[model samples]
Target: MTFEASLAETLRTFQALSSLRPAIDRAGDLVLATLARGGKLLICGNGGSAAEAQHFSTELVGRYQKNRRALPAIALNSDGSLLSCIGNDYGYDDVFARQIAGLARPGDLVVVLTSSGNSANILAALAEAKKLGLDTIAFLGRGGGKAKGLATCELIMPSESGAACQEAHLFLIHHLCERIDAAYAT
Candidate 1:
């Protein structure tokens, strides 16, 4: 696609996010509430979404715009050794779920990102989180695929283009980072 076309599509996706305010705000609220109670955030994704997860966690654990105490946020996909071990022992679908089981405690939140919302691992992660009595948040696209309604709260990018969905996810990550930084400013 041409630059102008890409820009237009991204604009449309961002515009649609206004209608998603309630859900988006709830997601932000989840993050703030978990942090306020000294709970950590456990995030996971696949491929590009994995990178997005790391970026979001880094923003919270490091900084968004200004100085703030480091927050607890783990990107479950960041550990290659652990992931390969889980995948080898259990299956790729259990990679995130197993980590959630082992690392999560009460008051923790599980956040998963997927443009397609159909990955087996993402689905497993959400289910594991819910089964453990933890609230789950999903950033998804393409009508949330089969993962819709599974999360306690979902931010579904109303678009079919995965690229547009990913772009939207990045924007929301930054937006949430701003809220987190302000809420826990040092």
Candidate 2:
């Protein structure tokens, strides 16, 4: 495919998901509500998804835009000690769950990203988040996987390609963050 064609395809796929603006808007509202109520946001994923989770958390805890007050956000996969200890003792599936149990409070939001939506560790974390009464969201692809079923709100792109799905997911988070800032703007 030529450069233009490839870019067109990418943009088309993004638009497909973007068309669900109503749902995305609702999810963004819930995120803002959680934060407004003094609840934190926790995110998790694996590999590239892990990086995305950290990126999202950083945007919130620092500022997606300049000069904004820091928001409370945690990327559960960032802490090496907690990840290693949880994996070593309780098993990999429980790594995120253990951290969620320790840090999450009622009304907090947990966002899980997985292209296949079946990542064991992430699903386990969702389970824990539910138990803790936290609002949950999942960025999923490929039939929305198990994470879709478990999350309170899910945004699933139609793309089956992992790279495309992840790229779209990152942009989705960016939009979410942007909406969050708008809703909470002073």
Candidate 3:
């Protein structure tokens, strides 16, 4: 697609997301509440979504736009050694699940991002997170695939285009960060 068309599509996706403001606000509330209750976040995704997960984690653990105490957040995809070992020993699908089993505590939040919403590792991680009594959230595309029913809360982008969905995910991440910062920054 041409640059103009791509930009237009992205804008259209943003417009579609505007209708989801209430859900988005609820998601922000959930994150803030979890943090206030001393619960950290464990996030996972694949490929581009993995990068997005890391980005969100950094924003929470570091800073979004305001100076504040660091919040606890971890991206499950950040550890190459753990991923390799898990993938080698238990198969690739077990990577995030294994980590969640070890690291997640009750009341922690697990956020999974997937454009297809059907990635095996993400689904496995969600299942593990659920079993461990962690609240689960998903940022998904393509009608949320099988992960929709699994999430305690979900934001499913309105478009099937991976690029569009990913773009929307970034926007949501930033909004979440902003809310967190506004609510907690000292």
The model with the greater lDDT, 1 or 2, is 1
* RMSD to true structure for each model, in Å: 0.8, 1.8, 0.9
Candidate 1, lDDT over the whole model: 0.95
Q: Higher-TM-score candidate among 1 and 2?
A: 1
After superposing candidate 3, which stretches have Cα over 4 Å from the reference?
A: none
Specify the highest-TM-score model's number.
Answer: 1
Each candidate: what lDDT? Answer: 0.95, 0.86, 0.92
Worst 10 residues of 1 by lDDT: 177-186
lDDT: which candidate is best? 1
Off by over 4 Å in 2: 1-9
Over 4 Å off, model 1? none
The digit string of per-residue lDDT tens for model 2 on 1-186 reads 678866776777787986767768778988888888999888999999999999999999887865567899999999899889889998999989998998888888998889999989998999998888888988888778877778888888777767778899899889988887776656
Model 1 alpha-carbon miss at residue 154, Å:
0.2
lDDT of 3 by residue, 23-119 (tens): 7888898899899999999999999999999999999999999999999999999999999999999999999999999998878999999999999
Instruction: Report the lDDT tens digits of candidate 1 across residue range 1-186.
Output: 999998888889999999999999999999999999999999999999999999999998899998999999999999999999999999999999999999999999999999999999999999999999999999999999999999999999988889999999999999999898788787
